[model samples]
Target: MDWTRQTRFSDPGRHHERLAALRGDVAAIGGVVRNLTVHYRASGIDFPPSRLAEIDTRWVSRMLDLDHERFGGAPLDTPRPIEQRLVGCCRDAALLTVAALRAHGVPARSRVGFAGYLVPNFHVDHVIAEYHDGSRWIGVDPGVDLSDVPLTPAGLHTAAQTWRAMRRGEIDPSTYGVGPDHEIGGPWLILDYLTRELAHRMGDELLLWDLFGEGIPYSRMEWSELPTELPDDLTHLDEIADLLIAADAGDDAAEQKLGARYAEDSRLHPGATVFCASPRGARYAVELASVNQEAD
Candidate 1:
């Protein structure tokens, strides 16, 4: 099925229908792989370790050379300002991954959650996939490649750490993972808003949000009223949080409300630093480094 153009969430039945489609598609595609190996003996068809590493991190252009070559001097799938275009770029990548895995007969589904990284950026988490390798589901991130560069200690940690932090209230549901308000418990208003806006932008294609699945946290609370105790050694995060809130409210008063805190905290902590201009996100990464460092 041409999932590239088809809406994956049109009907409630679509989800199950897609799974069936995937099963059938995998049976067909997996056959192709077997045929290629058995009939053709094309040893080159196999994914070399080096190539697999490349696939992991090429979703976004890393340097100027990459930007010029891969994305034509623009970020993928958008014709707007970078920040405003993030959701679309990310959603498209998610959809493409689903289609790619399905094409290969791998049962895959997209997931949204916090993906802590070593660098500071506008985005703190990632929305990737969990593919069923017949017996179990494995997290598959096609957001960016970490093959060339060593995985920073912060990035090296498993997704489970972020998961545990979310469940334990160490991380805020909103602004941690998928969307501004999505938590580990369930979807929140922010996701609803972003999804709706995206659907509208894409001419009504909400299926992208649920090609495999859309993860909403189990619960949520007002950011204005978080617990007194902060996550790990981020005692000062509260001050930054206040700044983020202020930044979101209006930038007229503060030149560097959200981005300012992010940049400062990032410099203060010594971890991996990728070239991302999102100040709020960079600061959050620094906060994570502080926690890991303290624990060490």
Candidate 2:
């Protein structure tokens, strides 16, 4: 896939001008994009219920709209207090970073997975932007202060990597999830994110909470809708995880095979609408659209 091309989710639209000012600085851009859960706890800031819903703003243009509306066309370097920033999740940070990088003619895309840096022994589901630096893809965590630094294991632990590890019994799937306290991690979650990693790799870069696969047994509308038991396809998911891992390891043949598999399988790519189980609140179906035309 062309990582440089803007997906509908990453296209800056009318706010295209704003991205130019950021100069493709992922770390600085991440600052202006407030993570909903992180900033709230750090600042102890109470917010309107509607404000929380901003997590569902999937389009980069819409996010920029909110940013401009709040800050009045300020440059991304200009620090906005936590309260004034657009409330979102790690996915927002990654999407905006990818958008900014793509704006400056850099090839970038978001990667979805679990992170071990958040909680000790727990891999929190996370997203980060990856830019193709001529020869290879580099991961950058805009949501953190790791500026211009290469992502190590302490940072983003890809779901594909973790999935393979779980399969080998090298790590427990239960330790990888939403948070330490939240009841959201398990092998099922890992199974879910494996599809997410594939989708991101395919350039869809959908939200982390968006489900995949066919029907209730293999997929659900949201985390709340998940079945108590694991999907009856651990063996199937393991095969997918193996392909994804091999591709990431720079196997040219594996990349070719994985790309073909993803294209042939509808489950690896989201359709016209994503069933959003917004962490902020509420569950709804989101119609997918790319920026074929500039916004109003």
Candidate 2: count of backbone clashes, pairs at least 3 residues apart or interchain: 0
Q: Estimate, for each residue in 1-296, the C-alpha lDDT of model 1 and write its tens digit.
A: 12233233211121223223333443332332122111101122344333222222212112112223434534222233332212223333444445445544555544443444623431344444445656654554444522211112233222233333444566554444333333422213223323222222222322222211122221123333444333354334334333433432444354244334434543222223212212121111112111112101
TM-scores, in order shown? 0.30, 0.86
Relative to the true structure, how large is the alpha-carbon lDDT of every model?
0.32, 0.72
User: Which tens-of-lDDT digit does each residue in 168-257 have in candidate 2?
Assistant: 888877778888788778877887788888887777777676665555354444456767877566675677788877777788788788
The CA lDDT at 274 in model 1 is 19
Cα RMSD of all models vs. native, in order, equals 19.0, 3.6
As a whole number from 0 to 100, the lDDT of residue 168 in candidate 1 is: 58
